[model samples]
Structures are given as structure tokens and as C-alpha cells.
Target: MRTMSITNARALIIMPAWNEEIAVPDTIREVMKYAPDCDLLVVDDGSTDSTRAVAMQAGARVLSLPFNLGVGGAMRAGFRYADRLGYRAAIQVDSDGQHDPRDIAKVLDGLDAADICIGARFAERGSYKVTGPRKWAMQFLAFVISRLAKVRLTDVTSGFRAANQRAIRQYLDHYPAEYLGDTVDSLVVAIRSGCRVTQVPVEMRVRQGGVPSNNPFKSGIYLARSGLALLLALTRKRSVLTKLEG
Candidate 1:
């Protein structure tokens, strides 16, 4: 793959939002502030709230789905948009403001040498911490995926990721909508399909607004679901790249 520099490449920030009307505006603002050169798109995953309208008002291009399709499906749509519009790279940022937009350029920089660059937490660069079963599950998943990708990854579940054209095409071919499929399974498939992967350490901040997905009590359930997701990823057939030429 040819090396693409964030300095010159046209990048798209793909924010997959679900009923995040409260957080999307601020997140969009921060992204614009930090990555003024890049375009922003919010994939409204069947949001019943004012997410799509709010995002559009906040100056982001919005793609509203008819119904909720989870992060993976939302992102597949985002990637298709990016590919169709001739974007050189795409960056994934959470809609809840957990991801610092300041690191967007850093993640994109990783793509000069890699097909996919993950913004990682718990990589000795941040104060963010997780404990109990969730921590264990994350560590296990990272360990397994690290070996597969041939890189030392500490946060495989992080949603803050950047992808070049190759990675974007790979994702459209096999990105799944099931639980953990967006983060784990799609990554496993991409790595298996010969995409290079790397990570940059990033600090995770508290969510600015909206309902949180995980609670302390649900850590055990997260563990089981993560393990099953990983198992399904490992056993699934490898993805064959479907070429997307502009």
C-alpha cells in the first residue's frame, strides 16, 4: 500500500452515533477545532432523538439509518461514504467525547506505516483504568489479537481508530454488526486479510453525556460476550478483499 500522510490526505472523521443528541454537538465542535482539515460525518444509527438534526446543525454531514444497526453497521455505511467520496483515510471517534480530538492527527499519522491505527488506552500513557472481569476480558482479547496482528496491543476494544483505504475496504467486506463485532471481529478479519495494524497510546476521558453502556455489575456479562465474539472471529472464514477503486 502507498503511504498516505495526514498532512496531505483528505481524511474523514466517522462518528457512529446512537441517540446521542446531548453529546454529538460538542464532539463535533471539538473535532472541527482539532482537525480543521478533515471532513466530519455522523452516521445516525436509527436515532429516535435529535442526533441527526443536531449533528447537521453542528456542521457535520449526517447519514441517518432507518433503524439501529449498532456500531459495526453504522461504520460500514460511514466507510462506504468515505470510499465513494474519495477520502484517503477515515478516523473513528466516539460521539460521547471520550476520545480526545487532539489525538486524531496522531492516529492518522500511524497510517503512514500501517493500514489500521488504534488509539489505545492502558498503554502506560493514560490514567484510565478498568478492573474486575472487564479488565480481564480486555487483556485477554488484546493478548490474543496482538499475537494475531503481530503487534503489542493493550487496548483492542478502543473505538478510536484510523484506517487508510486498504483497511476501509477490508472493513466493508467483513465488518459485523453483532456485539464486539465492530472492534474485535472486524479487526481479526482485517488482520487475517493482510492489513498491517498498530496502536498509539491515548487518554480516555469521561463521557460528556448520554447513557453509559456498561456498569460495574455487567462486567461478567461483558467478559462472556467478548470471549464469544473472539471465538466467532477466530473460527470465521477469512475475508477476501473486494476492490473499491475510485
Candidate 2:
């Protein structure tokens, strides 16, 4: 489906790319076609490859970080940029091409009713398939985040999401800074800060290229890190940060 027409969307698409030279260009082109109304910004997270050049050639405004900041750091930079640019809204799309541009419209729709809109891959009635220990961890995390959110969340880890002006302002001031911090942690931050968050069912395709940083060993570490993060989120004092009233 064509991206929702925002005639005056003033939207920015933040794509964090790191050594994704193989897929970044293609991803940018597709986003350009699907969401032409939105400005595309590719945050090159210090890729050693040609990600910056290729993304620029594909017509995306490129932000080349001096060093690899991981996806979460890169995302923070992108949001800060958006905040300065006076964008009305912004969405995060990975450069690996796993996200379907067609689903962007659906997620953007939630901005009408909520401060943050997530593209949920396993929401009720979603057709995407998730398997293995990864599935178990996600389901457990989803349950934990759902409880904190006071609403059911089927895909708490989804990176594909949109934030309205209110949420974007908060993001500019503060966002969790940690490996894998942007997903569930960001949701907790958003909710605790009083922002209303909602999800839209959106199926994700297999990643276009590049390998995940997960292995058996790393998987165990990830579980520990994420579990610790959630625990901290639970006990920490809720921020006095004002939630956006969109």
C-alpha cells in the first residue's frame, strides 16, 4: 500500500545503518517510493563499508557518525536531528530491509490517537512467524512490558515505530542509552513519562542481508541484559518528564 498521504506530513524517516551497504541503498529507494512525502535520513553508524556513499546516492540525507554508536545511539542522534528540524513526526526504519514500507502507513495512523505508534509483528491476528528461544524470550518480555504499560503489547521489541511531536520532544531531551536500549526500555520510558503508546499489527519480512549479532552465547547475554533492564525499569522512580498530549 502507498504510505498515508500527509500532504504536509513534515515527517522524517530515521534509518540507522551500520555495515549494511548491501541493503541500505535498496531500503532507501523503497522508502522513497512508498513514503515520498517524508524526508529520509540515513544515520551511518560508522560503517567501514560504503554505507554512507550508497545511501547518499540513493537520495537519503546521510548523517555519518564518527564512530559506531550502535542502533540505539544512532537513533538518539536521528531523533535529536528531527527535533531540530521541526518535524511534526518521525519513524524509525532499520536499514537491513526487514521492515516493509507498506506497513508504515498503518503505524503512522496511530499518531492520530497516541503519542507513539509501534509496528507490532505478533499482535493479535498478525501472520508473521517467530520461533525458537527467541520467541519465548519475546513473549515473556512482551508480558512484562504489557503489565507496566497497563495494556497488552504483542511486539514490545519492534523497532519500526512512529512518534508524534510530543514524544519526539521528550526523546530529544532523554532516551535510554544502552545496548538494545531503544526497544522495550524506550517503551517503558515513554509509558512512565506519561506518553500514550499504541501498536499496529504489521508483518515483517525476513531481513534483507547482514547477520544478526546473536549466537548461543550472545543470546544468553542478551537475555540477561534485557532481564536486568526490565528489573531496573520496574524499580526506578518514574521520571517527572511530561508526557505529550497529542
Candidate 3:
């Protein structure tokens, strides 16, 4: 595995939020509670609610967008911010609070051996379970991406992930805004760019608030769209990070 020392690296927790007024505050608070030293930035992805104000009130730096961009766009903005401010590492946390705040440090620690570390739900660490097409689709993507990345990755679509400086630069250059692009295609891009990837088993929790987005109907669509996204990522031109600035 690629090695790096994050012993003194400045880390940023990037929470991409859209219309998560109810959950964002508690999530931010929990992050502060667990990882108090890390800087927290909430990217309000054109939230139609008071996400921006509430996040700021909850003691996080808020980056507001004019319109709703999906998680991909919000994350792109977050990475750019991290790059500008010289954060050595960044971890993506859901504002809806499914990701456990206590695991933030574990995910960041993954940067010690890999450019990107994913907090995997199905890595035999948690009781997280998925049924039907979603489960099948996740398995297929994990298998394909593991081959491409040359690593045993059990959860390629996991949003709870961390990136070191190298991976952050790669993300800034190629992070996509398409459906499933943030998770699946983005990882493929990083792998193609010569970034090392790995995963840490993490438990998935029920959302503290907001309606769950996944359903039986959406699972079928996710299966199809995720496959297409992976195909496009594989066929897309490779962006080799020859000499990136830290």
C-alpha cells in the first residue's frame, strides 16, 4: 500500500447537505463531539431549507451554493475549499447522519496507508443490511472496482470516505456531478490516476432525520444507472496524476 504520515495532518470534515435542516445540526454537533480537533465544513448544496444558517449555528463553517447540486457538486466544492486552505486530508460525512461520527478518525487513519479510505458498510464490521437489487448491484460494483483498483474493496458506493492530499487533488481535477458519479465513477477515476484505495469496516446507522431515499423501485434504477456509470468511468480517458502540487 502507498504510505503517508497523517500524524500531524490537518483534516477537514466535509458534510454535503441539501434540505437537511433537521439532521445537519445534530450531525455537526456529533462530529464535534467525536472529532473535536478536526475542522468541519458544511457545504449547503443549494438547500431549499435553512441548512446554511442552521449549520453555521451548529458551529461549522458553511459554504452555500446558489442552486441545488447533488452530492457530487457539493463534494467538488468541498474539496476545492480544502485545497485552497491546505487541509492535508478530508473526510466526507453525510449531513443526514447515517455515518457514525465516532468512525471519522478511523476513516482518516486510512490515509496512513492509502490515498483514499472508504468506510465500508458491508465489510463485516456492522449489522448494516441491504436487500433486493441494491444489494446485488453493490456486490457487482464492488467486485468490478476491486479488480480495477487492485484492492479488496467491499463497498465502492459508500459515501463515508476519506481522501489524503494526493487523492484530493485527483478529486478536484475529475470529480463528477452525474448520478452515482461521486461514489463509483469517482473511485474509478482515482484508481486510474494511480491513487491507492482501501476500505475500513464501518457500521451504518439509520438516518437521525429526513426520509430515507432508497426504496425497492429506486433500487432497480440504481442497479442500472450504477452499471452505466461504472462502464463510462472505465472507458473514459485516464487522467494520470504525474506531478500534483501538495
Candidate 4:
């Protein structure tokens, strides 16, 4: 396994929260306990709740968006922040508390030689309950993404991921805007850019509160849109010439 150089200790953890006031503090606190050396940033995506205040109280730098941007927009904003601050690496953790902050070290370890490291929940056996349709949809999407990007990823939509400076800069430059389609856009971008991407086993939990934003119907639509987008992205010949050109 490739290990991160000691000099690259300046890592930042960014959590994009949307009305997750009740859970943000605990997530931040857990993350701090797990990765104290890493800085934390909470991107409040136009949350009307006390997300910002709670994040601040947890000692995290908070960035409030004037309007509600979906997950992709919020993540794009966080990437920009990481780039601007010159952080060596940035790890994205969801604020819903489904993603365990304790597995952050696993992500960090995977990033030693990779430009991007994604937490693959499928690699481990877990008790986390997922809706039947959603689970099937995710599996299908992962298969499609793997074929298009030519990378065998176990979990394509997993939000828990770590990226290096190069990955952050690339996302800031070419992140997709419309129908972000979960995190497929970011994963495809990283793959096409030839960024070294790795996946490690990580345990995930079911959300503690709040309804899942993506219902079965919404998930179907998202899958269709994402498939179209991926086809277009793969066929279009831009700067990313090969799967690992960079």
C-alpha cells in the first residue's frame, strides 16, 4: 500500500449539510475525535435550520450558500474552498450521520498513493438497511459506471471519499452543474482525468433521521439521467483523452 508522505499532513474534511442541524454537531465531533489533525469545513447549503450555528459550535469553519444548491453544487463549493486554502487533501463526509467518521482513517490510508479514494461499503458485510429498490438501483448504476469508466468500483454513489490536491483542482475546473446524479459526475471526472482512484472497505449506517431525499421514483429518474450523462461524457472527446491520461 502506498502511504502518504509525512509532508502532506494538511488535509481538510468537508461536510455538505442541508438542514441537518440535529446531526451535524455529533458528526463533526466524531470526525474531530477520529482525525484531529485534519481541518473541518461545513458547507451549509442554504439550510434554514441551525446547521451553521451548530457547525460553528463544533469548531468547524462554516460556509453558507445564499441559495439551496443540490449535493453536487455544495460539493463543488467545498472543492473550491479546499483548493483556495491549499489543503493537501480533502475528504468529503456526509452530514446525515450514515457515514461513519471513524472510517476516515481508512480513507486516508487508501489515499497514500491514490489521487482519489472512495469508501466502498459493499466490500464489507454490514447491518445497514437500505431500501430494496434503492439498493438495486445503486448496484446497476455502479455496474454502468464501471463499464463506462473502465474502473471496477463497488460503490459509485458513496459520498464518503478522499481526494488529493490535483483531484480538487480538476473538480473545481470541470465539475458538472445539472442533475449532479448523486456523485457519479465526480467519480467519472476523476477516472477520465487519470487520477489514481482506489476503493477501501468501510462500514456505513442507515440515516438516523430525516427522510431520504431520493425516493424510488426519484432514484429511477436519477439513474436514467446519470446513464445519459455518462454516455455523453464517455463519447465526448475533450482534454481527457484516455482513462488514465493524466
Question: How do all the candidates rank in terms of TM-score, highest first?
Answer: 3, 1, 2, 4
Flag clash pairs in model 3: none
Model 2 agreement with the true structure over 135-243: per-residue lDDT tens digits: 7678889998888778788888899999988888777665666755788777787788788888998878778888866667666776777787777666545555554
lDDT of 3 by residue, 3-109 (tens): 22454258999999999999999999999988876899999999888899999999999999999989999999999999999998999999989999988888888
lDDT of 1 at 227: 97
lDDT of 4 at 1: 24
* lDDT digits (tens) for residues 141-244 of candidate 1: 99999999999999999999999888888787788999999999999989999899999989899999987767877999999999999999998777676554
Query: For model 4, how does the per-residue alpha-carbon lDDT over 56-138 read when each residue is reduced to its tens digit?
Result: 99888999999888888888898898888888888889998888877887787777877888898887656554565667667
For model 1, the superposed segments whose C-alpha errors exceed 4 Å read 1-8, 242-246
Candidate 1 vs candidate 2: the TM-score winner is: 1
CA-lDDT, candidates in order: 0.90, 0.82, 0.90, 0.78
Which residue runs of candidate 4 sit more than 4 Å off their true CA positions? 1-8, 129-133, 148-151, 214-216, 235-246
When superposed on Cα atoms, how far off is each prediction in RMSD?
Answer: 3.0, 2.3, 2.9, 3.6
Worst 10 residues of 3 by lDDT: 1-10
Error of 3 at 85 (Å): 0.7
Regions more than 4 Å wrong, model 2: 1-8, 124-127, 214-216, 235-238, 241-246
Q: TM-score of model 3 relative to the true fold?
A: 0.95
- The TM-score measured for candidate 2 stands at 0.91
